[model samples]
Target: MKIATKKIAACAILALATGLFYQESARAAIPIQQWKASNGAQVYLVESHAIPMVDVQIDFDAGGRRDPADKAGLASVTAAQASSGVAARGAEPGLDENALGEAWADLGASFGGSAGSDRMSFGLRSLSEPGLLAKAAQLAARQLGEPAFPEAMWLRDRERMAASIRQANTRPSTLAGRAYAAAVYGSHPYGFEVTEATLARISVNDMKALHRSLVEPCRAKISIVGDVTRAQAQTLVNTLLSRLRLTVPARCAPLPPVAEVAPLAAADLRNIPFESAQAHVLMGQPGYKRTDPDFFALTVGNYILGGGGFVSRLSSEVREKRGLSYSVYSYFSPGLHAGAFTVGLQTRPDQARQAVEVVRQVIQTFVAGGPTDAELQAAKDNLIGGFALRIDSNRKLLDNVANIAWNKLPLDYLDSWTQQVEKVTVADIKAAFRAKLQPEKMVTVILGATP
Candidate 1:
C-alpha cells in the first residue's frame, strides 16, 4: 500500500493526539507509576496483567526537529540506523550494535521505532517473560547508547531514503504534505526533508554525533506495560541504559512559532497520473502545541467542526448535503510544538473543486458563528463517553504513555483528559479555535485536481 502525502501527514499529526481521550472503563485507576532509573532515565510503568504480552518503549528527544541545518538528515539517519545492524563497519563496536539489535529481536519479540519532528522512539513487544524481557531491554539500551552509524549502513540507508524521495514526487498526497510543511515550517528543521541532496550530505559522523549528543539517559523516558512492577521496570531501564555516560545538559529549543501563511490563491497543482477514481485534498495550517493551554478546547471544537466523522459539519456540508465527496474530516494535531490542524477529503476528480468550496463554506460558517451549545455538548459526550475503548489493551496504553513522555505532559494527563474535554465550554472552544486557526490564511493543497 503506497501511502500518500496526506496519509503521512495524517499519521504524523494523529500520533500527537494519541492520548487525547480518556478511557473511563479502566474500572480502577490504572496508575501511571513513575520512577527514576539509576541511569537517569525516567520510567512510567502501568502494571496490567490483563494480557500475556509486554510492551516497552524507550523514547528520546533526538527527533528530526533538532537536526542541524548543515546536516538536515542527521537525526533521521541516526534514528533509522538505531537497530538496523550497524555491524558492516569494521570492528568490535560495529559487531556490538548489530548483535544487540538481533538479540533483542531473537527472543520472541518484535521491535520498531521512528524519529518524528521532536522525538525518537524504540519499542518492543514481547512475551511476558522477565528474563526474556530483561535481555530484550538490555539489547534495546545498547542499540540506544552504542549505535555505530557505520559508513556502509549509513550509505545504504541514505540510498533507500533517496529512493523513497524520488518516489514521493509521483505521489500526490506526499507532495501535498511536503508542500504544506515547507510552507508552514519555513526555514525550520520541522520543514526539513530527507531529499537526495540532503541525505547525501549526511555523513556517518553526523549520525554518530547526533546519537552521541542527544540519545542520553536524561533525554530518555522508558515506559513498560504488562507484567511489570515499578521496581522491576526501574531496574530494567537502569541496567539497560545506565552504562552510557550521557551527561549532556538538556538544551531546550523553543518550538517554531506559528507562521503567517498566505492562502493558496493560484493552486500549485500537480499531476500524479493514477487509475484511482478520486483525488485527495488536504487543507489548513499548523494547529496547537501539546502544552498550549487551549489544546483541549481546540480539540473539542475541531471535533464539532469535522473531527466528529459523520457527525461533523464538514461531512454534513461536503458529503451528505452536497454529495461532493465520500468523506470529509478536520482535526487538531497538538505536537511537541504546534502540529497541523487539518481538514481533508477524498472525492471524485470531477467534483474536487466543488468539494473544496463546500469544505471552505462549512469552515467559514463555523469560524463566524462557532458551534452551538447543542453541537458542543454532542462532541464532548461522544469524545468523553467513548474514551474507554481507547485504553482497551496494553499496546494502546503504551501509545498514550509514549505520547505523554514525548511531550513531557503531566503524569495525570490521561486521568484528566475527560475532564479537560468536559471543561471546554462553548466560549472556550470558540476562543481557542479563533486564536489558533485563521480560515482566510489557511493553505490548501489539492492533489490530482481534475482539469
Candidate 2:
C-alpha cells in the first residue's frame, strides 16, 4: 500500500505577512458543534461570520494503508477518479470532466479530493451567496454518493499513472526515498512506493469495490466552516452526508497498530551508484504517531535541529561552517501510524561521507545534550509568535478542525498549541529526542556517481 503525499516544503511562507497586512485576527474560540448524523457519521461544525464563504470536507478511512496487498496504488486511483468525472449508472447518467468543472464554475464553487496514508478527503468551497451553498453541497454529495469510475477514463488514467511511476525511476531523490522507506519499515504497508506491477493489476472493478467499503456513512467524519448558522450547518451537513451508503460493511475491522521493526543495531547505509554530479542523502528512522505524548517537545526540537533551514543546527554546520552542501534539513512527519523523522541533503559525490558524518554528529550531540536555552527560547518564540497564521483563514481553520476530529485529538488542540510549545523545556527536548530518534540505528541511503 502506498500513502501518496503531495509534499509542500514550507507549510506557509507569507502567513505572518498576510495576517499582519490583512488583519486576520484570532476570532472567537472555534466552537465546534459535535454530533452524529442519523446515519452514524461523525459531524463537526464551526460557524464564523468573518467572511462571506463556506468550506466543507468529508473524510473517510480509505487511504493507501487500506489498499489490498496486491493492489498497491488502488486508494490513490479511486480518489483521483472521483474528481475527473461522475460515471454513468443504471438510470442516472454521467458528467464528463468539462461538464463538472463548468457546473462548479457557474456557481462560483470548487470541488476536489485526495487520498493519503489513513484517509481520503473530498471537499467543497463556495461563495455564501443566495442558494450557492446548498447547490454546491448537493453537487459534492452526488459525487461522493455515486462515483461511476467510467471505463473510458480508466485506461487513460492508468496509463498516465504508470508512466509517471516509470519516470520516477530515473530520478535519484525519488529512488532514495523509495529505497529508504523499504529499508526502514521492512514489509509494513508504509515500506513501499507504488510499483508498475501493482498499477497493472488495478481495474475499474477494483476501484468500485474499494469505494463500496469506503463511501459508507459510518466511515465518515464531516467538517463544516463559514458564514452558516447552526441550523444552516446542520441542514447542509445532513444534505451532503445522507447520500452515503446507509448500512455498514459487515467486515469493518479496526486498524492494526503500526508495524514495529526494531531499530538497527549498527549503521544501515546503502549506496546506489549512478552517474551524477551530486549525491542525494537521507537518514533517520521510525518516529512517532500523531497523538504521542511528547509531540510538543519533538516538534520544537526539530525546528532547532534541521527544520528551520538557515537557522537550524544542520544548516549551521553543513552549509555555514564548512560549505559541504547546498542545503540540509530534518523533519518528523507524524501520521496515523509511526512516521519517519528524516534528515536530507544534497552534496558533491566526493563529500558525501563528510556530509553524513556531520549530520550524525549533530544528531548525537543534540541527543546527548539538549538544545541551549537560547535555542529553546528562539524555537518557542517562533512557534508561538507564528501561531496566529495557522488559524488565520477559514480554509486553514477548516484543515486544523478536520485534523483534530479525524485523529481523535483534543478539540482544544489548536487552542492549546502555543501553550504546549511554551511548556517544552530543554529537558523535555532531550528526553523526547533520545527516545524517538534512533541515531545509531538510522538507515542512510545515498545515490551518487560510481567510480
Candidate whose lDDT is highest: 2
Candidate 1 root-mean-square deviation in Å: 7.4
Lowest lDDT sum, 10 consecutive residues, model 2, at 1-10
| Candidate 2 per-residue C-alpha lDDT over 300-400 given as tens digits, one digit per residue, 9 for 90 to 100 | 99999999879999999999999988899999888877888899999999998889999999999999898999999998889888787787777788888
- Compared with the true structure, the alpha-carbon lDDT of candidate 1 equals 0.70
- Superposed by TM-score, candidate 2 places the C-alpha of residue 203 at a distance from the truth, in angstroms, of 0.8
- Candidate 2 residue spans exceeding 4 A from truth: 1-28, 87-92, 248-266, 449-451
lDDT of 1 by residue, 331-412 (tens): 7766666677788888888887888778777888887778999998899999887777667566678888877766678888
Which pairs clash in model 1?
5-173, 5-174, 23-387
Give the C-alpha lDDT of model 2. Answer: 0.80
Looking at candidate 1, the ten consecutive residues that score lowest on lDDT are: 1-10
